[model samples]
Target: MRIFVLFVLALSFFGCSTKVPCNCKCPKCPKDESKVFVYNEPEITVYKEPQQLSKAQVYYKKQVSYVRKKAAPYWGEKAQVADKFNYVKYAKDFKARTIINFQNGVIRVETTDTANPLRTLKEVIASTLLNTQNPETVDLFSSRHTIHVGEPFLFNRVKDHDGEPIRWVWRANRYAQHLIDTGLKKDAIKTSTGVKKRYYVTFKMKQDNYSNSSELNYASIVKKQAKRFGLEPALIFALIETESHFNQFATSAIPAYGLMQVVPHSAGRDAWEFLTQRPGQPTRNYLFDARNNIEMGSAYVHILFNRYLSDVKNPENRELCVIAAYNTGSGNVLRSFHKNKDIAVSKINRLSPDALYKHLRQKLPYKETRDYIKKVTSAKKHYL
Candidate 1:
């Protein structure tokens, strides 16, 4: 019994000992796994490691950093710091404010209000970029920039004879602004100085060869001539339209010259000859001279008005008769009036200038004459 008791005591002591070795051991924990460990006499917890940045993100960050550094001088210190930390945010905000996007190899901007901050920024960027001697290529995202090369710019102003001012406002493209700044603004006028003077005899000629001729000029000229001859200005304008298409130097293949398409037979040779006969000159110049053209044309219209006044009492009818005579010759127009005299005056009166032109076109012998009447009548309405 004593030997068995001693053996049991030995077995219990061996089983309780921490130094004893075992055949199986537990698997080690992964580094990523959350585990508690002792460090510097304090308990610490371990977590999974963070991932490194991607290649694309790294490239973007580097690009943003470079741009920020380059823009520092222009944007000042605060912007530079913001760009360094949050370039995408800064760029997006700037774009929104300026209505301009300066990313993706182009700069785009828009402004409904001229005073827009973004518009100002765009101007600054454009000025700065263009002023550089070796500036990088820039693409503006607006249609205004499309006119920068070889496109014409138009400017127009109208004023009444009574000193009333009329304002004409036009939005200019970038090209137009550049042209104005570079002294190319005068190049866009379509009318010559001499032609414009004849059209607007009373109005002061401010600029030479400025392309525009206003309707007011035509109206005023017509008014002055019509008042002198006791005729309607509308009729005068209509004739002028048919004769010259409002061109001062308009000449016809049939030896007619000027805005009135005057022949050399009655006016004499040379522009000066018609007004003041020079010695040794037998005939007036065949070419259309602006002043001579208007004067001769107006005189012819006045004569026709007087000749047809007895049959055509109304100023409108007299004018139409004059235009018909100008197109079909006085003999043919007189014959047509005699043949159609029995027709109701109201029926003839209802005929519009266009209708009369169409009727005259059918009766006219020459195709050119017929077309001439139509063109003149059409132009008359346009100018009026």
Candidate 2:
């Protein structure tokens, strides 16, 4: 019994004295199986497109500069450059230019020198009919006497409403019917100027009904991509509305492309790498495609929410960070509170989401980013 007791005590002593492996799960002595938080950030490189403009782009730029200097046309006050969907064709032979603002759905045709302006105008109309992607039903804005191709739903009263004589009016209507026969019903006409003279025509693609609403138009794609990326469809919708006003071919001075206006060098590169596990710059054409734009944009949002700003404890707070970050960046979001990332994260975690939102709104570096957060958050409600 004594030996047995001695053996038991020895066992206890051994158990106490022997350095047992720590199972406390502290940071300093992490277990072999424990996960170590590692950020696998992709190495970003400068994005450069092939230094060649298509023939169409060359003309578009030339005409845009001329129009900016002379006509003072409204291509949406925000549009800096002609987007992909916005067509501007300059016929060097005719010295005529045709411009389309897809965002505002306005079309304009002007010529400094064209012998037969009517023929040139007809050619421009024909091209639009052939190539332009027609909206389901667009309300045409124009003067009375121009070619009225499609079925007119709502007619804007022409201020001066003067046209050629009765025979000319009849001929114009018949000619417009001929245009309709040639496949141009979706987007019709309102001519601001005469078909004769130094012809100038301006027409706007107006929204008449729910059938042509941009929200309903892109709802399916937004829902699909949002589901794929674990994002709110409302959030995606709001972002698109804010970024491009649902203009899929939207471009920015930063040279960001498509509906979400993704900058290829930063957000686009990161998101593409995340999705493909490869490094490559997305072409303007690729980003212009609605699916590609939303996919990449949503992927970047996922990165902002789940990866870069994941340290933020509150989901709502994290989203605020994401909204600001989408406009600026994660680094900027952190810097809004504290320059040091670790301290900023700690501060963010401690604050209520509402407090964090206030802090962000007040302290964000750029007024644009500050305004952007407000816009996105407010716009999100509509989608919801």
Candidate 3:
């Protein structure tokens, strides 16, 4: 009985003592399985907008200052300067907000409180339109004011814009109710960083008469970046079309950001280092800027041409490889031809530009990358 008791005691001690020594200075040792281990990542906040030259010189201007200390746009719609051309601002009380797309000449306003919704909505719309920089670009007086409400009962009341211009149109949108419900639910959830954000669902506003003339929204920036990097502006335009369709706030699960879909770790890090002679990942706000996005994307294309695929003989053929490299990588472009780098370069040089395009379309590993190269090349002609 004594020997059995001794063996049981030894097993219990060994089972509970399976902890390894840790060098961390925390009060609790992390190596111990019995104790809880929690790791909280630090949050990044961009305080200032990245400076870049613009032709129009229309900077981001706030309409009204918030009384509750409105924070900068942090991956939310509450207070986001979507891009140089678009802005989103929420009222101090969080009951009302406005989304203004200057390029497209559209203004959207949402109010949570249905009581006197028209009054709140009208005030917000008028204030936003008057205070916006470059009022000529938006031309809200000529542009249509579309007010959407989820509540069916309020649609008639809201449409009574009382002595306002005929431009005010109210529509009943069921999605608006869904948006409010979703925002309330999000407000209830606790965040890991202990910071709660209210996210209201937003819809794409209809384009006005002004959008047709403003098709090439960032053409000036494209020209400057292309000239600086020895690239055709048409190619940049094509890439923007294929990548994000010119959506400045576009982000992906791969975590690529902005107009050109630049991955911060890969293309962003390389382009930023090359441009500034410093090594660091660009913040979200930096990439969100239309000028900075085009510059970084154009710079990466330049790197692909001059650094990686420089050995290829024909500039046109080299551009084909560059496009593929932009979607995939330069290594994969080489691999598409041959396993060895030297042999791949030699083989690529031997093929005519047309032949190289055909080979790439057929041999590239990913169907998406293969399709990507074709889409960019095809879209390039539209810009030209």
What lDDT would each prediction earn against the true structure? 0.35, 0.55, 0.53
Model 3 scores a TM of: 0.53
Q: Please, what is the TM-score per model?
A: 0.36, 0.62, 0.53
lDDT value, residue 141 of candidate 2: 15
Per-residue lDDT tens digits of candidate 1, residues 1-384?
000111111121011111112111212111222222211111000001111113323443554455444433333332222111111112222221111111111122211212343344334323322221110121111112211222111112212233322222222224223322442111111121211110000122213222124334345666776675565566666666545434443333233444565544322222223234342211223333344455556645554454322345555555665666565443344334343332423444667766665666776545655676666556566544
Better of 1 and 3 by TM-score: 3
Q: How far is 238's C-alpha from truth in model 2 (Å)?
A: 1.0
Tell me the lDDT of model 2 at 77.
23
Ranking by TM-score: 2, 3, 1
Q: Give the per-residue lDDT digits (tens) of candidate 2, residues 1-384.
A: 000111111111011101112232223221344223212221131122222123323544554555443322222222233553454444424344556665565666654333654565665444433332222222111111223334221122111124221123344344333443443322222222212234556644444532136676577888998887678999988888778767665654455677898867557776776677566657766786677888889888876676567678788888888988788766657766775567889999999978887888889867788888888999898878
Displacement of the residue 159 alpha carbon in candidate 2, Å: 22
| Residue-level lDDT for 33 in candidate 1 | 28
Q: State residue 375's C-alpha deviation in candidate 3, in Å.
A: 1.7
Candidate 3: tens digits of C-alpha lDDT, residues 34-84? 422111110011101122211101221222222122332322233443333
